[model samples]
Target chain A: MWRDAALVAGKDLRVEGRAKVAVNQVAPYALVVLLLFGFAFDQDRPLLVQAAPGLFWMAVLFSGLLAVQRSFSIESADGAIDALRLSRLEPAGIFIGKVVAVAAQLVVLEALLAFGVVVLFQSRLGGAGLLVASTLVSTAGVAAAGVAYGALCVGLRARETLLPLLLSPVLAPVVLAATEAWRAALGLSRGDGWRWLGILACFAAIYLAGGAIGFGALIEET
Target chain B: MSSSSSLTRALGISALAAVAVNAWWGLSLSPPDKVQGQLVRILYVHPAVATMCYAGFGLCALGSICWLWPRTRSPRWDRLAVAGAEVGAVFCAATLITGSIWGKAAWGVWWTWDARLTLTAILFALSLGYLALRRAVDNPHSRALMSSAVALLMALTVVLDHYATAWFATLHQHTTLFKPSPSIHGWQLVTMCWSFVALGLVFAWMVVHRYRLEALEERYESEGYLVAIEARRAEGQPVSAAARPETGRVLVGSAASAERAEALVEDK
Candidate 1:
């Protein structure tokens, strides 16, 4: 299972690497979202700094949608989904691989957005340990759920619109917890960031297990 | 079928009577709350509607699980699943509306990030997604499987979401109605419990009707496909060409002819 997962992960990542869509498009779109937040907040320095954590995670959540869509869109093109099914890689492995690939892209996106938060919002970064832990767990939660849902909608004609509508509400808890954790890490809120990290971990575990167990059935029909 | 339809009619009548009595008892018969005064009346309707909302989703999850299990898989279970989800989504919307109104009256705000309110809103979205998925997938088997997967997912997320939101922020009052000692007594309690019975009957009636409608629709779809296939066969089309996999509509030669046939069928 681990070998299959790694192979699938490698294939997805290699596809993403060659395509450069995440880099050229999603990353800039995320940065632009941060800038737009600046505009929405009227460039209010204090408010922008205060809202940085939420704005940052919201950008990640949106970009994660694009990453998951791209991952499955690759499969749907040229009958690759049938090929993947026939390839005999375990469904759990495929699920984890998609999660890993999307999480990897999201990690990079988060790093870029973290920098944007600092530069654009003038937000100070403090708790490094909390920041890293929360990012890893929350990204896993978001990516696992996103990949599971992406596979569910892959065969639909209206997937482009349906994916976001279906996925965003499911990811609400992750966004809420991650934002709280980041706010604490950035010294913007007085809440315990570590406690929020624990919630993020719980969200990640439930989705990872749920996706792994259910992905096989989900994709069988799709 | 006659017995079940009779049962549904009986249920509908009982539900209407019970709701009427409960409304009168709650609005005018019961004394005003010492704390909330006249605004306390919202409790009778809001709590019952919210309970029905959860009950509907719980039924959906049960149907989904039964369908997912290989031993119990059936179109009946799928029908129940969709019926439960559709009815649940309606009650969920009502729950939000009633809860919002109560919140505005009591808390001076139309909405809040409280645990219960947020969770209901999320559940509402999940159900809408499930319905959208049902519409998007053309294959019946795929639709059942995919929507069942989504229903189970929503069940799992509801558990996680409950805890996540509870810890995030908890402004809603804890379970006051279902406590051991209970918070209210006498007429208010009677009225509230009666409201549950009333709304629960209504929920039952709606789900039974919806389930029946779904079963009939499935029959009609399969029968329509058969009729279309038979029509094509009479026209000397090959069986293989007449029976397309995704949609059963017969295709004659070019795309333009296909569209024309489709339009003719639509007109008829």
Candidate 2:
């Protein structure tokens, strides 16, 4: 099952490698969103520093969502999911593999957005250690939850609207904790951000377990 | 897994009664607070929704586990668990929205991504998405099974959301519902308790209703297929007798299409 899932995961990566769509499509959107966000803030340096993590994650989150939502849609659009199901690969493995792919996309988007925030807001980049950690932890969470959810709602009516509505509420905690952790890591406040990191860690665990159990059933449905 | 004929109807009536009872205590009977007064009245719907959301999340986890067991694939066990998930998600939405209203009244903010509040919102979104996934899918058995897993995964987010502050410096306040009262204590507590019973009844009713629909739809489709297959068999080939009216519908609920019925025929 693990090997099969790895193959599925690898296939996802290969597809993206060929198309270069995630970075090509989603990255520009994130950048434009960031530029617009900076423009709206009226050039307040201290204020922007305080809000930078939020703005960064906001873009990452929405962009991450766009990326995650498509993971299942791509397969389902062409009846690829039907073939995947018939292939006799374990559904849980498929779920995990897709999560890895989406997680990778999220990481790329976050890195690019982080760079943009650093340049546009002129925020301190001295806390590279924490910034990297925060982004990685949060991205893990986004990938896990997105795969499970992506599997479930991919076939629903009004899927586009439904995806965000359903995901935002559930994903909000990871967003809150990780973004705060990233902000704190960036030197937003001296107050400890370890608590947020712990929450992100916990979110990742829950998602992993959830994927194991939920992905099985979701595969049957898909 | 099947409810007796009268029992299903009785449960249905009981659910309606619960809604009425909760409405009275929550809306009219509970004494208005002397301090926060009517603003405190918001307490009625708030606790009900929050607890219901928790229960729904619990069911999501349970559904995931059950889906792994082949026996649960039967419409009987499968529909019951899925029903719990759908109702649970609905309550989760109630929890987030009502909590926000309460937050706005108490904190002067419409939305705060606090650890607990934000988590609750995420939970609601997850449940809604879970339901949407169910609708989007074309298969029946697979739909129930996959949703079971999605519910479980989504519920896992609750643990993170709950403990988010342990990792970050969250402005989101810790739970105040359980805090020892400084004033208006006992009476306020009583109102909350009463509201709980009322809401619990409603939750039970919601599950029963959704479950019935699931069963009926399951039965209607299966029976429809049985009818088709029986026709096939009557034409001199072998097929399952699920098409016969003697069994009625094995699962329940009304179906919009026979594709699902056809899917079951393929399985059998």
Winner by DockQ: 1
lDDT of 2: 0.73
Ignoring the other chain, what TM-score does chain B have in each prediction?
Answer: 0.84, 0.71
Every model: Cα RMSD to truth: 5.3, 7.3
| Model 2 segments more than 4 A misplaced | A1-14, A42-46, A69-105, A148-167, A205-221, B1-35, B56-64, B71-73, B97-101, B157-191, B224-268
Task: Tell me the lDDT of model 1 at B118.
Answer: 77
Q: For each candidate, what's the DockQ?
A: 0.79, 0.54
Model 2 vs. true fold: TM: 0.74
Tens digit of lDDT per residue, candidate 1, span A1-222? 888899999999999999999999999999999999999999789988888999999999889999999999999999999998899999999999989999999999999999999899999888999999999999999999999899999989999999998999889989999999999998888999999899899889988998999898888888
**CA displacement after TM-score superposition, residue A46 of candidate 1 (Å):** 0.9
Error of 2 at A215 (Å): 5.5
Candidate 2 per-residue lDDT over residues A1-222, each given as its tens digit = 788879988999998888788868888999999998888888988888788888888898889788887687788778888888888888778887888889888887887887898899988775677667777888888888877777767766667887787677667767678777877787777756887788798889888776876676566655
Report lDDT (Cα) of residue B52, candidate 1: 84
Candidate 2 chain A least-lDDT 10 residues: A213-222
Clash pairs (backbone) in predicted model 1: none
Model 2, span B112-211: residue lDDT tens: 8565766666566667767776676656766666666656556667676666656556875455455575343565666677677768777776777777
